[model samples]
Target: MRLTWIHPEDLIGHELRQARQDGRAVEAIARRWHDAGGHDAPPMAGASPEPAPERLRRLAEDLLDELATIPSPLADREPTGLDAVISACPDWPGAPLAAPGPDLAGRLRGAWAGRAAGCVLGKPVEKIPREGIRAIAEATGNWPIRGWFTARGLPDDVAERWPWNRRSAPTSLAENIDGTPEDDDLNFPMLALALLERYGTGFGTDDVAQMWLDELPAGRIFTAERVALRNLLVGLASPETAVYRNPFREWIGALIRADVYGWVNPGDPARAAVLAHRDAALSHTANGVYGAMFAAALAAMSLTANGPEEVLAGALRVVPPESRLAVAVREAADLARAEGDFERVLDALHARHADLHWVHSVNNAAAVAAALVHGAGDFSASVTSVVSAGWDTDSDGATVGSVAGGLLGADGIPDQWTAPLHNRVASTLTGFNGATFDTLAARTHALVQETSG
Candidate 1:
């Protein structure tokens, strides 16, 4: 009975760590866990299956409850509510007045295809570190990630040392890819699309919760979304589902679901952020919510942006200027612009955010921004650069692909990247399995017209 992500004992250890990062004083709580013979939580990426004794489990549950109520010192500056978030950003860009252009369909098509291509590219190495990724890729002659990873000539030692992510390798490799395989990175955007179609852009948080129960498979969701699913099943409501016993509230789950919001609200970052806020509020808080807003804003701007620098600057306007996530993006973008080499920029970012979990919103968002800034509007360069940085590779690649794709349009992305997808994608959602990206783009474009009108 040791479910890896949700076991109360395991969750308490992670919650303690999360609280401390939020500037909450948790020294006494850490001492209590140590006194109780509990080890610190395993790294967020590792699996631990040994069941805790009953006493420890109860203590863990009680501690999680206590942790939820403790206020972080940064709370006021990092408010989660949409209005408060907008208020915190003094230079906030009001909603863009520009409408989607005649080429909207092509841009949307590029975004969908680009997202799938980039996601597929990073899948095989999702959890491997930067050095390991480099080692494996260099060994296979794919270093700098010019294309999908391969085992064709990888050394046995390199293969053993940096094994491909088990679930991703069989389907995501260059030789094995048929159509895009089902991945949470792509699934969430599909879910967002379904949500808009069902409830329109004005859908509430409850609507988001209900949609998951109806369409999103419980097993497919993870981390914060998993906790929120559990909360919803037990009858806990919207905003509460995001916080109760949910230490993963600030992780990157919300960020990945942001693209459809931006897609439908093309050229309007402020409105895109508001829609993203509604969706993100169901499972995330603080910087987690901000991460979604940032991505949605970026994606929205990409439809009309002249280049990556414009996309980054316009997106930054939606995030709270003083929030840690904002500071990280600004620093990452600044360093990328100044240094001009992605590897050096990544090293600086990795060292600066070493204390963060691999899936945390702040670090992953920083990496995405750095990639876009460094890539400077080249579709191949942007997606490849982000995946190479190694934190949440698939997710970062998908977001970077999305923004860059929207900017470049379908005709601009290289055929090498788009051809493998066969214009198709797979999903666990009811109507999306084997759906073509162009069809999805048409459907999404229809919404853009509807919403804009």
Candidate 2:
């Protein structure tokens, strides 16, 4: 069944109507277009805007009719399973990469710690507008943002317009920082770990859907996952749960959950990407799905990659080369390499992504690519640039941090980044909350070994 009634003021609904005629959602393809510097729909020809209620009614009617018709050829694929995804992967450019020598456990530890640190760095400012983060950072002497933000002594007028994540500020700020707090960015990875342990590499999309039903809290899920959960609750099946009323299917949710797939696969990028696809397909499709695969592949290769550049290249090979997500990632990589200043690269990213939703995976993938490429193997440079670049700051920071940390190894990660956390990470998952990175890393290393064996 259709969502039937979307919020009247929802801009996604507005874009959905225009997109539906072509059988597209407001994300993925659209987000990719924006991330590569495309503009939004030109303003209505006339200055006077149409009435909201009438517009909503017309849009709703148009959407229902559009859904009844055959989707456009350009529209994203339906549920075709892993064979479709395997065929989609761009052929490996060179021999499959080998895993890093020595310190496997250390690298694993670093990834978990770095992900936590970078996520915490951006947490307080997660959804704050890019300019707002800039303004607040500049005010607090943190612009070009080398560290976590603090609320101490900022002008109210500036702070008023650019508020921190109110729910996050107490722990995310510099002074109060203790441990990595609960965030879906980390939570999904935890859930993924559970999924892997229970089903090994054979787990399918249906397994992931059932796991979510058993473990993840409804309130904790958002956007696509939330929509998919509602769909599952109401009787939608495996891939159907992803599409039914889930316009958010292409948002950053899947991307945020991909690290575990990579962590368990190490140097096996193809395997990692496929596992990510199985997991991502439960709630996302197209580039949204590709975002997870790309990230997981990056993580898998980071275990052995000589540098972020090599990791980035391996990642591109795991997704359809022609996909908009790949296009956006390629653009971000190119722009990042050419642009010298970290903030300037971000300025370019923000400008190009201005037309898309802040949380869309295409734009977020661009942000992640910029962080990895420009970061060029430095942990601080990597996390700082991604977080500073804005547009879902926490997720970008967390992902970049994970890649960089994996590449750098635990011993290589600076104390300044990890010490603040006291070597701890948190999640609400049973027996997982407030766990030490050391323990998680050890478990992850054992699992990766078992899977490879």
- The sequence of per-residue lDDT tens digits that candidate 2 reaches over residues 173-196 is 998898888899999988888888
Prediction 1 TM-score vs. true? 0.98
* RMSD each, Å: 1.1, 6.0
Q: Write the residue-wise lDDT of candidate 1 on 103-133 in tens digits.
A: 8899999899889988999899998999999
- TM-score (C-alpha) between model 2 and the true structure: 0.87
Clashes of 1: 0
Query: Ten residues in a row with the worst lDDT in model 2?
Result: 39-48
The whole-model lDDT of each prediction reads: 0.90, 0.78
Off by over 4 Å in 1: 44-47
Choose the strongest candidate by TM-score.
1
For model 1 the local lDDT of residue 31 reads 90
TM-score of every prediction relative to native: 0.98, 0.87
